[model samples]
Target: MMPASSATLHVVATPIGNLGDLSPRAQEVLRTVAAICAEDTRHTGQLLSQFGIATPLLALHDHNEEAIAGRLVARLLAGESLALVSDAGTPLVSDPGFRLVRAARAAGVRVSPVPGACAAIAALSVAGLPSDRFVFEGFLPAKAAARRERLQRLAGETGTLVFYESSHRIADSLADMVQAFGAARPAVVARELTKLFETVLDGDLEALLAAVQADGNQRKGEFVVMVQGAGDDEDAKVAEGRRLYARLNEHLPPSTAAKLAADLSGAPRKALYGG
Candidate 1:
């Protein structure tokens, strides 16, 4: 049982796709709170109606969050327990409500969490990729050039790379990923997780790209794309060799820099010098 406090703000997690995934505690928080702050009031209203919860909802999305946060915090400070929820999944994980949560904490109001389903976690669990240490990069840039540039920067990541992609751009994004990270790099595309037609496809980047392109149905839903990180040994050699080459080149001839860098980084001198 949640301890009822004087001025409490509950950060509740809601179901992403399957309504059954909503936890009992989260439902209780939504039901008992003085009001629920929602990213989309209409969407939340439907969910509450389904559960027979009659709690009043206050809209607090990205656009109006800054403007409304002060008023919501005042309500919390006035001894009204408030619950914060997003359109789906956990609040503030690629969703809105950060301002209000920050305001409530800064004002000394107690904030509690009601954990539940998250799309990224759901996808990662079934991605067949390394999950011990991973990074959740919410969404990639929309433009082709920018997206590829970002992927290029993340090519050397040592932990699994997770990203959320829309149905429209999933194909293009996967193609760019294949170019940025080598075609042989292992990757997975988890689509429409926890919902009907859920699909988790794993293979090398080239194969996954081909699969997504060939099957139009595969590109019709929300996606969580996971790419295997660079191998530690090769990544370290290339990265360290480049770094040493850059510094040594400033003080010595190109050949000498390449040789010294190769010796220090255990990388071939010809490879480091583009021979």
Candidate 2:
């Protein structure tokens, strides 16, 4: 056996949907840890109950983090090993365990990762969307105006964009994406994930929007939305500028429109002006 100086925090990844995905080692660790810190103690409690793990649980979430980290670290310092878990996926990822993980590390406590399912990665795997180079944008701002602005900011991101969204707002958000990213942009929507009704719908921005509208349940669960990266063709990029310049012909002046269109469409300002 190895030597033990003191206790450390274990950052574990819980199943996103399928309970069967929980690894055996993770199960054992959860059962024996001095305590378990979870985003929602009740939810984690249920998961632990399923596995017959009786470890004590501490509720650690966004609202209570600052007040909790100090005491949690002290417990770790006192040789109380703990496990940190989000409601789903890896801890500290769009979840509320960042402060504890950071504090534990700062205090020289050992940190171990128990890797498992992540909704974003899981969605990407089955989405048929670009995965070589991608970014996970946890969730966008909720306001329609703010969300649209955010979508505008990411209009031409080169890598495929992935974001988590609530079912209630998925339709509106997709519509905004259509406005900012274009209706014809290829996209995919993965719903419910690894659950019994897991669904993945693929289409352009508009087509997916329509499909979600037609099927009432399309907007009924956690959603992982993936938007394709900008087309790589230099000529196509130039053509995009031309199209935007045409739009600017109505809303703005030539020079101003050229800059705006270039920024939005990622085209050459000079080429847009020339066209």
Candidate 3:
């Protein structure tokens, strides 16, 4: 058994879905900590109850994280070991607790990680996309225009892109992705991961959109959307050319727009003009 030291903060990763995924080390840290700082006290309370752990729970979510961080840091400095956890998965990976971790570090308190489950990483492991180089874009903007704008910016990215999305907006988000990244871009939609109804669907953007639209069930769970990155230099050039063509086509004829976009982006005019 490892000894819990004073003036240390243990960052524990809980289960994303299946409770069995929580590591033995994470459970040990949770039991040994002076207290567990959670995004949702009640939710974490339930988990602790299952394990018969009696450690006290303290709420520390986004709204009051800044205010609570300082006090928590003081406690850590005063020799009270604490554990930080989110509702599910790793803390600070689209969840809260960054401020507390940062504060503890600044106060010269040791902050340690008991890593286990992370939804993004979990999804990426089975995504079948290029995982060597990828980007995790937490949650996109809630608004359609903002989300589309963000997708447009990422359209040219060469590394695989991962995103967390809610069920309510999955359809619209996929539609926006189809528009921004093109219908043929390979993508995967992993839903309800590690849960009873876990589903992982992979296909071209348009096909995936159709699958989701055809089934209401596909739109009912938490989602991790992984999009294959732009291909080689030639593929990137074509993507850039298409983006430019989209804008210039609005103000110029199709042939003229294709020519200008190709010249500016170093793409082939024949490819842009569909020749």
Which structure among the candidates has the greatest TM-score? Answer: 3
Ranking by lDDT: 3, 1, 2
In order, what lDDT does every prediction score? Answer: 0.86, 0.85, 0.91
TM-score to native of every candidate shown:
0.85, 0.87, 0.91
What is the alpha-carbon lDDT of model 2 when measured against the actual structure?
A: 0.85
Of the pair 1 and 3, which is ahead by lDDT? 3
lDDT of 1 at 180: 67
User: Which tens-of-lDDT digit does each residue in 152-239 have in candidate 3?
Assistant: 7787789999999999999999999998788999999999999999999999999999999999999998999999998888878877
Q: Which is superior by lDDT, 2 or 3?
A: 3
Q: Model 2: per-residue lDDT, tens digit, 140-167?
A: 9999878866776666577889999998
The reply for model 1, stretches above 4 Å from the true place, is 1-5, 236-275
TM accuracy, model 3: 0.91
Cα lDDT of model 1 by residue, 1-275, tens digit: 33333778999989888999988988888888999999999999999999999999999898999998989888887789999999988899889988888888878888999999899999899888999999899999999878866776676678899999999999999998876666888899998888889889999999999999999999898899999887788864664575577668889999999999899988778756864
